[model samples]
Target: MTDSNAALNAFFKDFAQNLGRLQKGADVIAGIRDSDVDVGSTPKRLIQRRDKVELFRYEPEVEQRIDTPVLIVYGLIGRYTMADLQPDRSLVRSLLAKGLDLWLIDWGQPGRNERWLTIDDYVDDYIDEAVERICRETGHEKITLLGICEGGVFTTCYTALHKERVRNLVLTITPVDFHADVDDPAAHHGFLNVWTRSLAPEDIDRMVDALGVIPGEFMSSIFSLMTPMRSLTKYNVDLVDIIDDKDKMMNFLRMEKWLADRPDHPGAAGRQWLRELYQENRLFEGKFELSGRVVDLGEIDVPVLNIFALDDHIIPPTCSKALAAKVGSSDYTEIPLPGGHVGLFVSSKSQGALTKSIADWLQARDG
Candidate 1:
């Protein structure tokens, strides 16, 4: 055989390999079902419900190692399901395996009727009530409060107001100093802070009043703008890259499902989050108010553990690190983990470290 026969064979071999990959990809896509991509599948029982909020206690995965119960408080902007997005990648599962008595508060989707709900209501009323209920149910005077993102702000405010009810406060990817983003060196990090500041207070107020509730789609669009290239290529480039691997494709789909489930932010709360905190930098200055009471960060004297993602573009490290100087806790700890905002909980590398750190910290202070 000469060069002509060898060239022909090589061309056919390449064509056959490409055809096999395409067939496998097609089969994988065809087999995927709605349930295959379902997120937040960890088993949990509903403990109580109040208005749009519901409290849930996860069934124990192991014997409770610590006496103090742990309540996970996620922000209203996104669903609490994110903490338990999947069986293996779930923060809820990781902590439970460490013998934590984990409970979560779900701020159910708010409609137009909830437009009047403000930050004061979330911090002073709803959260306070949840804390009392947890105390009563667990027979523990004080429970550990683990707040994430905006929920961290709510928990911080609550701890400042009623420090006795909290034993340990764990904040994850929480921004204490909204304006601290200005100091962030990364171009991508703190776009939300800058964007929020670009708007006038009246502009935010007017948008909230006109819409009644901030639409989830609108918020999603703003987030997409922060990472425009990734958002644009997610379906095409990202999905295509993972299309041949079942596990990788499933992970991508589950994340997309979670992102699609964003809930509307209540109007009054949205207004305050944008104007009072992001715009005015009120929380860091101790000028933020809830129920006629100022939220003085210096008053949070509980054992506080602040965790922030080092590469978090959404909530810059500078924004979260600022909490250390303001809090009055004699026992304070800071954990800087690798990954971005969502990756802190979902990334395999970070989630294990995150949960273990929380468990160890809580156990040390459990007494």
Candidate 2:
């Protein structure tokens, strides 16, 4: 090679190395932010979803036994505790402060018994049972279900199947139409059609039989790839800030704890989601079957409120906004917030505005 060419190659090599260093540094910092070590621990209560499912509960309420209770259901992939971070910046606390009785659905660590847990089992069996229990406890026929992201679809499915149990419905950052033009295929590795659809119930069993519980790390890694460099960049940034402020370091550590604390999703439901929602676009098409029935959005007739983030990477507008069209609830309203998927619930910016808006939306249904 010529001398000029060699010099230019060396410069490019150094630039590549530097970029790698920067990304690695940030990932480390971001990991720190997502941990239990950095951020102060949250106050959580344990609720028995069944005799076994130990759902975590966080109540920041100074008052109790209100007229209409609030139930917050998080996505199956991530721990529910993400919504209950710091007291000063908590969705649970904010709802409680608004004088609403609150209950959070923490789907807890699933075991082998939960291995074959289908989306049917979750929406029909677990959620329906929980709603029934909550209703009996409060003596109210209906309860407000606030579902976030993937949970929103689950909630909508439940409402459609059993509208009698749901009074007011709230869906935030949920993806109903995975086949939307804007939905990011980056979240899943292969084409939604071939790989996921090829898998049968036996396939899911074998995959889980080989590994006791599917490692949350595998799922987290996929999410990290969506913003390949962001996690690394945040880690480096956290370390630098840790040099000066102790709270920032603590906060960073706490976030890392939460981020790392991903619970495994049951393989069967995962396979179904991959095949039905992502691959075939069943839910939006009114062909998504759960618990022996097709999911027709027209069946979701209760008062519904949909919340979307202006820039949610995990779920883009197409994934979230599609709900506006399918649901039969003419009493529907959509609120778009200025934040990313994760930031929509946790950021300080959401505290003053979006959180209050959430409570206000719930309050109108309190009567």
Best of the candidates, TM-score: 1
List the candidates' TM-scores in order: 0.95, 0.81
> Native-vs-model 2 lDDT?
0.74
In candidate 1, what are the lDDT values of residues 259-296, reduced to their tens digit?
98999999999988988898888999989999899999
Error of 1 at 186 (Å): 2.2
Query: What TM-score does structure 2 among the candidates reach?
Result: 0.81
TM-score, predicted candidate 1 vs. hidden true structure: 0.95
lDDT of candidate 1 vs native? 0.90
For candidate 2, lDDT tens digit of each residue in 131-240?
88788877899988889877888898999999999988988888887767433554432232334445575655566677645568877886776666787888566465
Model 1's C-alpha root-mean-square deviation from the true structure amounts to 2.0
